[model samples]
Target: MTTTAAPEARPAERRTAPAAPPPVRRRRRRGDALGRTGPSKYLAHAGVWLYVLLLAAPLYYLVISAFKRNTDIFNQPFSPFTPLTFDNFGLAFSQASLGTAMLNSVYVTLGAELVTLLLAIPASYALARSKGAVGRMVERVFALGFLIPGFAALVPTVLLSISLGLFHTREFLILFLPASALPLTVILLTQAMRAVPAELEESAVLDGAGPLRVLWSVYVPLSVPTLTVVAILNFLSFWNEYFFSLVIIGPDAALRTAQVALPTLSIANAAQYGVLAAGIIITLVPAYLVYAVFADKMESAVLAGALKG
Candidate 1:
């Protein structure tokens, strides 16, 4: 301290060193050469719209024709629009027993979905949690059912129904349709259930929850989106089912479903385009209503199913 005083600090030296330069963010402006859409993007958009138009064209025709007479439909086959008439609907409902058929379809589709969910949820949960020889075999069997066409089961199902005195009845279809839909439901739900974290179940168990309680409280909540998907899919298939209804509930106006009943209108009308169009619209309503209500949830379920944690 006695030798010399320290040199006085310079103003530049006293200032803090400039803070490290902020991270450089290179933001590309829109409409820049690299930001412009590619030819492939346009082509993909074109293809998608084309496919949509192709599908929508038939539906447009169906609606327009539904209000037109058979003569008008055939005579003006390319007519893009027409005066609206509801007589065709009356004709369809009256002659086809379509009213009753609609009710029957509601019963079958709802009953089948309910039964499938009840059976599939528990079965899928068990299968997803198990990893033994028996589980593998059972899973394989369910997978095999997916590959086995419904046509193959038709005869056996009818035979069983006849034997058990359950044929030609809604009760028979309620049971049989669910059984037919079960394997696919189980497969979808089993995969979805696997997506639920095991830790949730363990935590529930520590809270003194039993297996069933844990399932209802934990895994079930997590798996709800996928379950809605299963219900919607099964509802669509069961509602549109034709062959099974045609054969199983055949010729029975009281028990027939919409698909089965609609054809009778065709046979009677020489397949009147107008009346059949009305019938088609009637047949599509339930499925469309379901999709409209659950479309967002269904899309979420699909995305969730595609990704695994």
Candidate 2:
């Protein structure tokens, strides 16, 4: 008892909790340095908004015009957002024979895309896997297809169609579109296929896969993104192809594509801006739909291709 009371226990040292290591101010990365400044950030936002407005302007006009009367379209061109009517769409559908025309467009577009892929895939695979200078030379030859102006080839195409006795037939479009699309399609696919590892092909071959099997099993699956990109591009090009469809398919309402049929709406009602706009909008839907379905894939494909390049 005497020992316990011998000395007054010193007051226990008061512990101060460590100040939370100064709320970690993470060092800004060099890539993000430009985004930190207020002025630069605001300027970037302003530029983006300006660009968006520029792009949206025409679309806004198209949509507004589609619902307005011709007089309204002209007089109040960019005013009053009321008094909308769906009459123009009816006029467009009836006058343009849009129902049949859209069907024709769909048929031709899908057919052309299929034919293009059938030819382009094999050609691309060959070129991609070729080791000799001959492949490079052939690819350069294919590139020359771009040099031949589309307008310049129109005459030949017309004559070729006539010579084959396939003039004014949808079948001819199936044949022709693939020819036109082949150069770009083959080039893109070749590049994409080249990006596929040689090991995959070798493994495929060891598994008793032939060239065609290897292409189908190895290359095609890996190149889906690029294939999608090519498909979308070709679809749009073939869809909006007014000049070719008009010339090749002829003005026959039974055969002409939507693009060709759309102008007929204008002919029937020269001053009906709404009808014309409606027809254009109708023609645009399929393209928009295709893009919407595949937009994300398209973006990734483009980024991948760019990085590979």
Candidate 3:
């Protein structure tokens, strides 16, 4: 009777023991989860920083090389930290034809972005709002473009341009470049337009606004971030474009884009690495400047997309 009574009392005491607080239990759980994972937070951050350094090294070299002489660059390749000079820049501007190329690039890229947005906005809105068979078929066809590489269509596009008597012309490039934007622009705009509430569109219609008015007033304002993103993307693509520009507008010095002009720098001024560097940097400036000016818009676009996602 004494042994059985003692065992019963021990069990009761164990059941009454105080458990850990909620916060303590949560902390323990999180720690256990992290332990099961591969790396700690500090180790992960260290790896990321290391990757960034590796990526940035080439950009640093390019910038520094732009200020040094070719001899200095080849002899002391790693000594880009030395004092800077502007002679390479002067040479680059004079020999690289950057002045002419930059103006042409600006015109081409701006026109491309404008035309792309105009075409994409209407198409995307239609696809997003309509659920008809034609709309679905059109959407699938547009999506198919993504699987096809630009290079694959080069010969066909060139042939088509020649047939239309529009080959090797700025008009041809402006029209051609915008077409490339169609697939991505349509996809992005459809997603963005779909996110806008249908009730808002109906309300705008009830308020005595026409379709055009509603698009400009209601949809445009709501879709600004997405539009900005698409415009920026198309702008960069047109600006950096090399192949189409080369093939379409070849031997036409007046129509050569910035990227097309870059290779000519090395060819014309053989062994002048510094001039080549400066020309490359010159090509990059306009894009960077545009990005900097629209930096706020970029941040907002990213944040809005994140929240929507």
> What would the C-alpha RMSD of candidate 2 be, to one decimal place?
14.5
Cα miss at 174, model 1 (Å)? 1.3
Q: What TM-score against the true fold does each predicted structure earn?
A: 0.78, 0.79, 0.79
Over 4 Å off in model 2, which ranges?
Answer: 1-55, 69-75, 297-309
Those runs of model 1 whose alpha carbons end farther than 4 Å from true positions after fitting are 1-54, 297-309
lDDT of 1 by residue, 87-119 (tens): 999998999889999999899888888888889
Candidate 2, position 118, lDDT: 91
Question: Per-residue lDDT of 1-309 in model 2, one digit per residue for the tens?
Answer: 434432322111111112234223234333354675777787887898899999999888889999998888988988757688899999899987999999999999999999999999999999999989999999998877766667677878988999999999988998898887788788889988999998888988999999889988899999897898888878888888878788888999899989899888878887778998899999999988987887655554444434422
Candidate 1 vs 2: which has more TM-score: 2
Number of backbone collisions per candidate: 0, 0, 0
Lowest lDDT sum, 10 consecutive residues, model 2, at 8-17
Question: Can you list the residue pairs that collide in candidate 3?
Answer: none
